[model samples]
Target: MAVSAGTVMPAAADTDPRGYLKIMKAQEMWKVADGTGITVAVIDSGVKLVPGLRSESVLPGVSFMEPPLEHPDQQYPPHDDFVGHGTTMTAAIVGDGSAGGPQGLAPGAKVMPIRTSIGTPMAFAAIGESAKGVRYAADNGAKIINLSIGGWWSLDKIRSAVEYAQSKGVLVFVAMGNEGDGNESANPIAALPGVFGVGAVDLTGEPLPSSSYGHATDLAAFGSKVQLRCTDNKGWCVADGGTSYATSLASASAALVWSAHPDWTANQVARVLIQTAGAPVDGSKRNDWVGYGVVRPRMVLLDRAGDPGAPDVDPLAAPAPAKTPTPSADQTSAAPRRAESAVAESGLSWQWPALGAVVAVSLGLGITVLVKRRRR
Candidate 1:
């Protein structure tokens, strides 16, 4: 989801001023755990060794792209990113803020870049390649897999790969697509079981109009106006709206939690994230738009909130039960009141405001492309 040439804008001179980090209170949380000893596998175009990314922070990776006939010597290196989308995603997770670049939330975590043909004409043909990349990451000591790519159609190969990763005790976070309102299509991989589907939300905790909504959406995160280093600019670029950035941040959040509790299984970490999330505005248990609520890792880090439920039981294994209207007073008043308090306590304002007009930039492969896996 590279930004179109017309929408590209010069970044401000400020160094590593990511507003979402402040909104999520990530800096404060870093004092407790900065995702050390964790490795997040970024599955995207490729991760260029930008100044923002330290060499040690990025591990040697594999690329699934075949060499183009015109460039016999050009074996697409996993560290060479042409589209900049993958670089942006990587920076969001593990950037070190060198050369006045964006600093990532999980700065202590390592990134394993798994390159695939995304944001190109070969995107549709790379579905199988991406699936293989997933398995590769899962088997190669990656604790979490960050997928900033998505499509409208599902493939059995991809589903099977995701299941394999889950069986290997890997956490997969995926972008929930950016088709705005009226578009009912769900990103096939994001909708799969055991995957954490992430949506985009602004500072005010309002869902971005372009964020795709459905039962698959598990959580929302700061995505609008997110600042990151990318190939689009020599410095930084602000992404107006995209679920891709949200997914990266969510992956980083998981890394931070897992680092703090190294002994916790993937299910335990997932349960704590769900239980500690800011409650939905409407006070329902969960909603299609924002899922349980915006991710508030600060709640878990600072306040020591959230219960790590059964170690073997996955909180997201089954679809959330439908919101049943009950006549009980405590169910009606107490829950909604507590939900409202929780939203405020988590530092997300419920007041919705009209989004200002800005040059919107697509920041990952999921936003601008839809690949259909051809059926046999």
Candidate 2:
């Protein structure tokens, strides 16, 4: 519904220069106001209180490694980021669109950060840490949780955590890992039953050549050399080409739709993104690789007409019709507990991205999920 063309760094308030539209064009997303008051949890390296992000919007964040000030040397956890992947993803969701930056799809949405991995052993540890981080976010008030990283295993504890988060009415977004190199495996979060997995598409609206393929990738979005806000203060941040940025962007798009229609279930949100998405090559429909196709957040806003056919039923109200795997074998299995939220009283069936939404992430776990009455 909102549109703007930006030029140069530090562009005028009305003119956002970053081509991505959301991160650089702050006011643009605000005009439609689908994400006002919504909160997103960015489970990544860490958020450093960048410009235009609201202090009030920020909740207490955690990290496997201690804060930089506390651990000047290597004493802190090894999860401190060198790749800057998490920071770049954060800007795409909540950046103020400052100085020719890409405006996040939901600029008003606050971020809750959790830095779990930073490559190597610590990154491997993130496989376990992600379950903890997602659990924490759902326990709090995060409506949407974004995971731009992933790997190959699915642990029972992690499966339980995903189920718990969904029971609490949280929407999760995950990235299908990049396809380059020998790294070709099923991404974990994407493989999970409820998480929305994303893939990368270039500016030309084609799936990126580097995007890995798997059952986890449920949808695709712009990636490529697209730019967004950066912690580097350069006003032009290039997201590493892959589904990492795509997942983050999809999460922001979900924030926009959720903010506009808070009562809808997560399944409804997924249906909206799918039913409204624009097909670049063909008509609106699902493909093995692209799923329902590229997500068109604006369509969820109902600002446009005659795009994709709108679905009548909520896709996620009912659990997956198929059997979802659980990782009960691991001795380290400890699933996070979930507490019910306002969704139950509403009696609305919440939907989510189908199981195996784990394509774009960098880590994986093999685990089983079990259900039991949870106590608060």
Candidate 3:
């Protein structure tokens, strides 16, 4: 299972001592765009409504997890957070910092929390079902989607869902792994064309040693020692380090930019972000360590240096011509395609026959390890 800020100046008087807002110049950027009218979908454990989240910041969401066998039709509220990971990620995107809560980067944006299985017996299978959640987000008017989880499995369902969302002009942000190495392509979805793969950086703006890097690594953002307030009342918890937090920041930043330029296409927004990212000392050189560079939304919102490139041009060239992703052993159903209105209506289109069995028997231990590693 995989799971998932602050501000300001004048001597860290704000709740966030790290001064991410001051460093990113978020307040200055907010003067121009506070992510108004933008909706970001957070696909993770689940998001539980808490005081930190504004009353209208969250929308009703659907879960892909199958109910316990005893009650096949039992549906869990989308606001429920099983492991506290989803709620934290949701807060990072739209939290208002009310009552000592951690403030979100895009405070004016709204979030749709979609819960999949995390740290559960059905983790991997639930991950396979993420394709449905991705499609749902794109269909439900989400402009930006945040996926803080990743797996080594290369399932076609996930790939197709990503491509579908892109075709709908939705920008997706994915996390590069946190295992210290930079071979981010090891995770299939991160390797997908047009999908943004984000890596982790320390408060000093240097790439974290634990952040993964590779050709799939598209951008980097603050991830190390970042403060997050869990919605389950666990107050502020600092991530030891991982790309998950970085992905959320990048997604929220995208919302801010999109909100500012509502007419720009997803490709144009991505191009601006890449063009304005902060590079390391040898800025001219691009490497696997950090693609383009760490995200600096201020460059686009405040400095106004980001050039929205050709509307139809893709900022990231495909790693290779898009190859058909093979469905892993756990995937039995074909990826959903257009002209499937009936299937979509039924809401049973993406289920796999033996996914439950595979998830129950083999994925628990491995997913447990991956989840723990992400938490660092």
TM-score of each: 0.82, 0.69, 0.78
Error of 1 at 229 (Å): 4.5
Give the Å error, residue 269, model 1: 0.6
Cα lDDT for residue 257, model 2?
A: 77
Q: How many steric overlaps does candidate 1 have?
A: 2
Ranking by lDDT: 1, 3, 2
Error of 1 at 212 (Å): 0.7
**Which of candidates 1 and 2 reaches a greater TM-score?**
1
Q: Which should have the higher lDDT, number 1 or number 3?
A: 1
In Å, residue 120's CA in model 3 sits off its true spot by 2.2
lDDT of 1 at 211: 71
Instruction: Judging by TM-score against the true structure, name the best candidate.
Output: 1
Writing each residue's lDDT as its tens digit, candidate 2 over 243-317 gives 777787788888877787777677677767766665424332343235456666665564542222233333533
- TM-score ranking of the models: 1, 3, 2
Lowest summed lDDT across 10 adjacent residues in model 2 is found at 342-351
- C-alpha-based local distance difference test score of model 3: 0.64
Of candidates 3 and 1, the better by TM-score: 1
Model 1 per-residue lDDT tens digits across residues 205-255 = 666667766667677776766555434334665545367777888888899
